[model samples]
Target: MGPPKPSITISQQAFDEMVKENIDDLGMDPTEALQDAIETLTLQGVDLSGIVTCKEDPVIQSLDRLKQLNSNWTDRIGKDGDEVMDLLDKLTELCSAEGSGNAAIGTRNGGIELVCSVCSKLRGGSDQGLVSGLKTLASLLHDVQSGDTFQRSGGPKMVMAILSDISQSSNILNGGFSVVAAAATGNEIVKESFMELKIDELMLQILRTHGEGSIHSLYDAIRILLTPDDNRVVASQVYGYARRFAKTGIAEVLVESLKEGLSSPSLVSATVTLKAVAVNDEICRSIAESGGVDAVLRCIDDSGEQGNQTVARVCCSLLSKLAGSDTNKSAIVQKGGMDRLIKLAARFSDDPSVLQEVMSIISILSLRSPDNAARAIEAGAGDLAIQAMQSFPGAHQMQRNACLMIRNLVARSPENRTLLLHNEIWGLMTTTNRIFTMFKQSTFFQELLI
Candidate 1:
């Protein structure tokens, strides 16, 4: 033999204990827990390449039992289907393994057949078996390799069919929606299937009546459906999607949900989704009228206190959009929104995007509502904008928004103009105006000189 094959040295007792800890303490599936334990040991410099494997007979037996139990005993498992899902998670892990080609071909094919069978069940009736099977399929798809294999086997279209099939019972719908969401994670093709089927509106309805323990799944589905992966960059705004989301009572649901003060992952998704749709004036008005302004303001304040930057960022964006409306701008001002935004601006001055949004909101307020503009001025909004423009001289949007807001403030009240001159923004304004005029130059000779 070349060199001795490396092997992991662990007592069977240690392996068992590790697996149990991962399952009970960490909430990992048993198979994953086992794999994690082995990997952890390897990372610690333990060799696992040459461990004497147990006989194949027992592993084959377990695989057989898992397939049978996932398909047949699903209905027999009690409501909520936790027990069945646990077994399926284990089965999913097994089917994706390769063991002398024995586990690879047979187990993988069996898993696909089982998913197809489960998808077929979703087409008609609803039962514990159907629900449990859908949950299992979701777990299987949670693995990237496994989901790809399933999709290649025509399971993606099947999943989409079930997602779009509104006739299914609520139980099946809940389970199916969740499965589709999990399967579609980072899978653009699956995402397209949901979009192509035009299930965005229907999914929103399901989200309104979302099941008890499936809030994440429902929210995930809605987020992915509303916000595609590619556009999740600097500008995640989609006007059409926002318009449609507003039509589906999304604003009302999100606003009302925040009112209850329930803390969940859904809040982040809701805020992000709201940001996407708040481009519409109707949605902005609805958000404020639905008390979303207050809710979002509180979220901004609370997220800052809790160091939840993501929620704070999106919540601020939502408020910025809401402030775009003339009526809502006054509402935000009366609610002390300017003070909060100013504080946030100071705290996050190092962040260009956040500063841009803050200045943009001030621009809108100063443009529409003189009273709010006065309040923003009182909050030192002029200085804040000037600082932001100075900090990011190359950011044309920030500079443009700042100059526009300063202009609006001065135009709104002679007092604000005096204040602007007092703060010494006159020089910055002159420089910015010249730069803007240079940017506006269209002639090649003028551009070359610059």
Candidate 2:
């Protein structure tokens, strides 16, 4: 009804302290002090809308506010876009708070339909309002129950319409894709509904049109669509989706994004999305043939140079996944993949997680390939493995990964076995063996060492 208040948070202790100050410093009764505190904070422009209180349900109150705004939409349609945006922002904040149950409550109270209506009304009128509405819808859909409600309510169609109408605005597309991704997570029926809607085609069109704009959430949505759910009975659908993505040229577009000098977040998102789509050997080879291996290697090198361990670690993981194809393994080795990995290992030597990922790539590369094994040893793989084993003795996974890398390095090359043993690997192997033996339940460890 008036100017929207600025949304702010106060700690429970701070709020209590303020109430106590009113009681002690002003000699006010407890009820009077609490009321005075609320009035003072409200007059100072701090929005206490969703603040937890013993007397009222904040979730219901927030929903009522949204309903009020929606009921009065006609009167404020063109005159109060800012107020609409502010309400949507507050709703988004409430729904996003972890463990608040606000999303579940909102979902039960017809929140999806309310927000979708707002989105439709804001279409072609207020971009910011529409974006905020979409974001709030996404937050509400994070709950699985909310997702099912969204699916039955034809929310996906509304989202697709909004995305199509606003394909030119990166902000709107991001928010829209966020909703799509949230709706599709762990919900196979909703995923199928989206697939029937030809969500992939629409997504590819957006990627092609806005590829340079770097919509990170768009890549995330693509990954979620192609990923399988917990229901293993329908897990085979993921492979089909992977092939569809590759055939539709999604793989090539992702490879191109990897080659671009994207920021760290964008680079990680693109790499992760490509990794998700490469579900089979053929798609892995397809990515490699499209220069995916070279692009990933460059990213590893660049991220390592900048000391960005997260990007370097993710790039290495993607490269490892791509190297599941024998051809890509060879391509990676020839394009200096092993060299880049060794350098990455050296740069992030203190980080066992990155070291473990590098070791994993080496292990994959050397699996049954004596020449690649020989090349890895030459590129200092043995020394790297030994150093990792020594430095992080308590790092169980890294130790296991190092053992696997050692096993692969020597499995086919007798000379490598002798070389690694002579480099005092026997002691490190015994140490790792002892570490695993202490666990006493790791049959996989015995398999690796043997």
Clashes of each: 2, 0
Tens digits of per-residue lDDT, candidate 1, 87-173, equal 554554554354433233332435556656644643444366566667656655544445556667777667667766555666677
lDDT of 2 by residue, 1-450 (tens): 764554675654576688899989999998898898888887877645334443355666766777787787784664467877887898899899997767766776678888888887887777788888999999988745677888888888888888775354899899899999999887777777887788878888888887634577887788888777735243547677777778888888888878884463477788888899898899999888888888888888888898998888888889889999998988999888788899999999999999999999999999999999999999999999888888888898888788778878888788887787689887666766655464447443344344
Report lDDT (Cα) of residue 267, candidate 2: 74
Name the top lDDT candidate. 2
Give per-model TM-scores: 0.55, 0.82
Q: List pairs with backbone clashes in candidate 2.
A: none
Per-model CA lDDT versus the true structure: 0.64, 0.81
User: Clashing residue pairs in candidate 1, if any?
Assistant: 7-47, 8-47
- Score candidate 1 by TM-score against the native: 0.55
Supply candidate 1's per-residue lDDT for 31.
70
- Lowest-sum lDDT 10-residue window in model 2: 439-448
